[model samples]
Target: MRAASVLEADEGRLPVVASEPQSASGLATRLELLRNTLRPTPHVPLAMEGMNLFAKLEYVNPVGSIKDRAAYWILKRAAERGEIRDETTVIESSSGNFAAALAAFTRLVGLRFIPVIDPNISGAYESFLRRICPTVVKVEKRDDTGGFLKTRLQMVKHLCATTPNAYWTNQYGNLDAVEAHYELTAAEICADFESLDSVFIGVSTAGTIAGVSRRLKERYPKVRIIAVDTEGSVIFGGTPRKRHIPGVGSSIVPQLLSHAKIDDVVSIHESDTVEACRALLRTHGLFVGGSSGTAFAAIKRYASRMAVSNRPTVLFLCADRGTAYLDTVFDPAWATRLE
Candidate 1:
């Protein structure tokens, strides 16, 4: 599809160009439009007994996830550095949200997107990618740790080496992903609250917590930065096991996490993740993704141990909406299996 046609199909939501040129300058203009589309997501108060808790509504982004920030920033920075041209195909290994975000933004600039995913990707995300992306590579083979991440990364490497004009965004180790959250996500949080006592962040590629923790520490040095990981995730030195939650944790420890100054780590089981998600929907009417539920679970765990007098202000990111998880997290059958 032509860039002009794609922009039109967007229903005049993005900035328009009369003629779609495939030049570097043209790509920059399209990147600028993508950047302009990002707005500061709001933080709403979540009622707890003692703590002043708030959840950052990152699911409201253009592609409905916090990954939108990193995906756009990585692509925009790549364009500025002359790493990607109009003919370049953007490739990445993602479970769901990142791939969806990349597919959406790359289509706007007329670039082909190939997402190297695995079976763990949610049905909603897989269907979405199959519809929008030019190619979706699903690696069925699991690696030594019985996880698909290593196998997916291997496929990404193979695709990048074989395909001409292909660029791997490499979200796992990309500092641009860190910078995106540091500059945009954390900056927005800082602007919203003058003082924060604690922040809970979910770990996957580790970009979000790494960037956010560094930035928040610089602003509120005493603020506790808690890294939330799933029970099976190896990101925080846990034993590797099968994890059903798509975006909550990781099998491999992301290099980006090495840059973070984490205060503590909270590992939650998939059952707790499901419970937290259901509770958020039932109590607060917030339908959030698995990772957000994981973070919320960590928040509750942390708060329960706190002294009665310490009713500190806390914030956790609601990474994405729960519509994508209806079949898994919200299903009674699935919840029973987790138990």
Candidate 2:
């Protein structure tokens, strides 16, 4: 272990896949569960009565979220680059899940972590991060610019400037996050579903749309990739998604999104997302985080549009627990925003 540390010291940053799990077997189980849940099925019958739909159950992942894959990739890549070390302090600005995932990944690497949080983040998620990581910084939403990455980017800018020996796993711009999905998510889906028709994904940093879409398209040349965004999202709406689902959709067109192969963009209303979230909890008992709801609402719309009995359709579910949105989508007072 000391020799490996010395090798990393000389290497600058480890190449990729550097962080090792404390229990390889446990990580193996987590990976298998992730694959089983996220892995696309060949032709599962549509759960909805009339529509032909098969949703990839990402909400079934252990972390109760889909961003865990990105979290795993980003942290692992940084270690490969030797960007993160035992004495290194990691920092990231997040609304919730990303921060939580970062804390978990850092804990695995035995690194000091400092999560820069926004006021919009859920208290449950914030408290959980505090317990997992050694340091946490709360940045008020005083200058909160709803979705243009204003609040988060600003907080990260501050941390990077002041903190020493700190590494920012800049997920927003990192290609590794997308590659993680390309190598894992996309390939697994294609291997199972040979005749995939269309893929539906919610856009945020647009990595999910970009990576998985590109991979699926490469495999299923005739496949249609529909990128979904909230009505206020900047991807196609050309404005910030000012709503509470801060993690997905943005004011700026994410660089990761490849506009050409992107076939089309679907904009779902905030109200629909709330409804879908409630439905997931009631029917499937999947208490997902907010981003998954956004994707779910979009795919449900797509299913209705096809209105077919056997059209192949796939949707990405971003997470599993509403624990992150207890005060927002789950609370009656706050949910009234949808009403």
Candidate 3:
């Protein structure tokens, strides 16, 4: 069977481009198109001392998260490799954004998608998945690591083994996930800002940090790559506790993470995430997710420690929008429960 040509797809098709080009002039203001359209997310500047703080609002992607890039890159590569045809089913484990992204993109290419999620999955995200995805596997149990992430992966393994013509993106270890951010997200940041001194990114599957950090290091060797993780996440040599935030932490260490590329590590608490989220909304009018709050907290911590002369242009990667976290991060009552 001849594989689908990426560029010459039918009208109202999916995966038009593997990734959006690194040019602001290429962005379209129109909506009412396919949900899988990959465009340049905005970079909103913020007020801070010493350093110039800029927030990369990745929530504006077609699926309203940065994972749109990663999911598209993986699927595009799968198509290029002849791994996905008209009838292939793609299965993967995710917390939220990645699942929603894959669901949107898979529908574009006429493929089936199943996302194995956990109990901590955001209410908004779950509803989004239900609307777009045909089947969503909810993993209620936790693994020996005391987190549902491993359990979710286990379920994915079983499904892939039993289902014929099933393909697991295995995003936790997928290098393509890293490549997506490197070629697109990082390139956009560099293009938008000619001189950047540091970048703070949240780590979960570690794809974003791994790719972006490597790219920045190659170009600006002195640029600080700070890794922000929640307290419960084991990614940054922390004890595996329970993390409330979905996008910024991990129970299991991701294969894509390169510790050598990171210059600093900041572990944020759930309360800090909440406080930062509220602050962003009140002060900057940026309604972002818990992980974005985590990144904001990390930005303050990094800024406070640096001397005035040492301060530089700092960028924070906001993982997703507050809409997906409305039930918890934005709700006063629900947020109190976590406290």
Candidate 4:
């Protein structure tokens, strides 16, 4: 009944009672530990005007952020399918969380990892990747979209083709990324909430929202799926512009986005994201990242403007911790300079 023991039990298996039967079925692989070491994040509830709110604290995952779910699952499946071996090098393009998650697990399995990122990668993220991943590729040139995303993917393709034993995780276009969230993240949400009215999720690679929406809509056909994006992001038909926030928006539309299922798409500004992050810390005692704040800000607008049933339950996926954005999102000077 001790707190530490209870937490350990939660980490080791699903949050079931000790009397319930659970088995240690498989050999403890590094990927298994990385993916399964933490329990499903808590759905912390809060009272709101038109609905009940729950923040799914995804930052508590092993490597921080919901990307851990996709990264671990992608690598594990690739290894199982004989696409990757112990000596094989894993290559992927990422701005931050996905690469960091991959670096952590690949280091555990003794595989070389190269994270192809852009020049705009944050200091905190770059330093974290450097400490964990030895070979980090920085793509300096921007593509036709005036964003480095296309350029990064081009580098990934080149590396995968030329490097021996190299495999590209291709997170942006990978169906496995969506599959991972469908099986793990969506399942966790359904397990926690029997009848979810709506879910507010950010779209970057679009895997999380696409996977979760597909699974939930399969069961609860009426569940509302709302996508949270930034002003400059082209995901929801906005014109691409200079966006300073890393986690919230993407210059190019992701292949995994499901346009039909998304009932509403809200775009929040960088200032709104900053305010929401500060407000969350001040009011809810949650120090979350920009993507989370973007979702939060969008949810506020949704709750206020959109007509809805009284007291419906809404969920927000808090993607990562504010600690990762201390140099930017949480810093007044840096945020001011960006503005």
Candidate 5:
């Protein structure tokens, strides 16, 4: 059955897919179970004076990151559209969270996944992907901006052209990535909070912020959509430099970002990102990823400028777990170098 036939789209809400239990054996049954097992992550309140702050604990998702939502939705939609067959191989270029997500989901649905990764990938993520995937492609060359994203994309294209029945997920340009957040992640936030003054989102491929900002603006017209980017990222037109953090910045601006309704852009330094990560662990006991720390630092800076009487109710996404950063952000020596 075609996805269009099985899923009904609503004007202002998520598309409803068929939820009936499948009696068929093998892949079909597993897909149904996977869909059924997917649940919304929680939003926990953070103690702060004047303004009500809450962090959406997206790290609790099956693959331990927000990318799981996008990975599942993209593959599911592709299968419905007849793009994924039993012999098809799914390919994507990612350094960390997204790569791990696609690996887990594709394996679950009986599809072969090959991640074109770079040397900058964290040890934890590299170990996980190598264990599950038969072949992991590594690109050693860097692009003009000294990042491997462009080089990785070139490898992805080459692999797709040479490999039979290869389907590239194309997370950077894929509308499915944006829709996943709009329909699932942002929808959850809107349902939880009737009113929000602003939302701080960390930018990478810009999928999460683009989708969440658009949806939140539709629900709360006046809510400020803040796009938090790293200093070296060119996403918001900043000069490109070497960025140490994996998921917080991008050398190339994502196409999905054009669809967002951004009110302001805040550029954060790597130093601040490290400090914020430690601060969250020390103060709130929330051990989140580098991007989450960047968002938190941006929120604190943004809030400092606001009048005390009008402190806004703030919401930020904790994109992934910090355990992957044990060798970097959570390391005192590593963090000290950034200082």
Candidate 6:
């Protein structure tokens, strides 16, 4: 069932709201399109009952994470441009979510996936990918020296160079992720919501910043797109330092970030992130990952900046269940370690 009509002052320029599907194949098509059209899932915050805070539940996507959107977009775009075919094996390096998503989706479409993972990731995450992907390559995260994720990716590049047919999604630095978010997420925010005060999001490679910020600016030029980075991330001009928050806190600003005109970059502490993840689990039944926990912390901080009314403020849970983070974020001793 669809809702009633909505037209704004500059409505026609906006693309039609993406239509939902009713069947399995139809659902696949819808999800594929969703990579180019993510919608805001509305929800009310407990702290603010009368004043609703819309947290876009991105974890609902098929692959148990929002990275599924980027996967679909980049893959389809690749198909369109003759970059990949059915026989072409898919490849990428990821902490877990992106690789897991690629593995699942490649299986669904009868394609092969190669996941390049680092030793720093959780053991369970490694096991999960091994089950999904046809081939799993682990890179050393050594204290002294190891090629790690970066080195593993270079290895894949070398393999692809020699191999006859392989498709590298290259999501870490891929502009496709940025373009995917731009097409789907940012546009949805402008169309569905009216006059959003601020949006809180965790930054990884800054693709979300470029994508989400671009569309928000197109709609409400004054809309506040505060790019949230973890304590160790270089995104907020911080010195590169180690942090517990995963899927975020990169050592350098992503290449895609150059195109985005970000309003403000705020860095949050790891302690706040761990606490917020617990709060989400206890209160909302949302066991989100470290980056989402970081996002939640920023949402609280950004919410203070929002007008104390029913005005909608938005944030996102980028991936699904903290089952992946159980050993760390969900563990008491882990919290104690951070504390």
Candidate 3 residue spans exceeding 4 A from truth: 1-36
**lDDT agreement with native, every candidate:** 0.89, 0.66, 0.80, 0.81, 0.86, 0.68
Best by TM-score: 1
Which residue ranges in model 4 land beyond 4 Å of their true spot? 1-30, 307-309
Deviating ranges (above 4 Å) for candidate 1: 1-21
lDDT tens digits by residue: candidate 6, 15-107:
122232233343344336544333454443445432455666677666676777788777767766667665577778787777877776665
Per-residue CA lDDT of model 2 for 206-282, tens digit only, reads 76666788788888898878777787766775654466665667766666775326887788777777888788778
Candidate 4 structure, TM-score to reference: 0.88
Model 5 stretches astray by more than 4 angstroms: 1-32
Residues 1-339 of candidate 5 have per-residue lDDT tens digits of 323223344443223333332222334445556765558889988887768899999998999999998888887777766677666788999999999998887766657789999998999899888877777899999899989999999999999999999999999999988998999999999889989998999989988988899899999999998899999899999999988899988999899899888999999999899999999999999999899999999988988764548767899999999999988999989977863
Clash count for each candidate, listed in order shown: 0, 15, 0, 0, 0, 1
Off by over 4 Å in 6: 1-46, 49-51, 142-149, 303-314
What C-alpha lDDT does candidate 3 achieve relative to the native structure? 0.80
Q: Clashing residue pairs in candidate 3, if any? A: none
**Which order, best to worst by lDDT?**
1, 5, 4, 3, 6, 2
What's the true lDDT of residue 187 in model 1?
A: 96
lDDT of 3 by residue, 115-182 (tens): 99998888777877776666789989878767899889889999999988899998988888888888
Between candidates 2 and 5, the one scoring higher on TM-score is 5
lDDT of 5 at 95: 91
Q: Please provide, for model 1 over 268-300, each residue's C-alpha lDDT reduced to its tens digit, 9 standing for 90 to 100.
A: 999999999999999999999999999999988
Cα lDDT for residue 53, candidate 2: 56
Candidate 3: residue 81 lDDT (0-100): 65
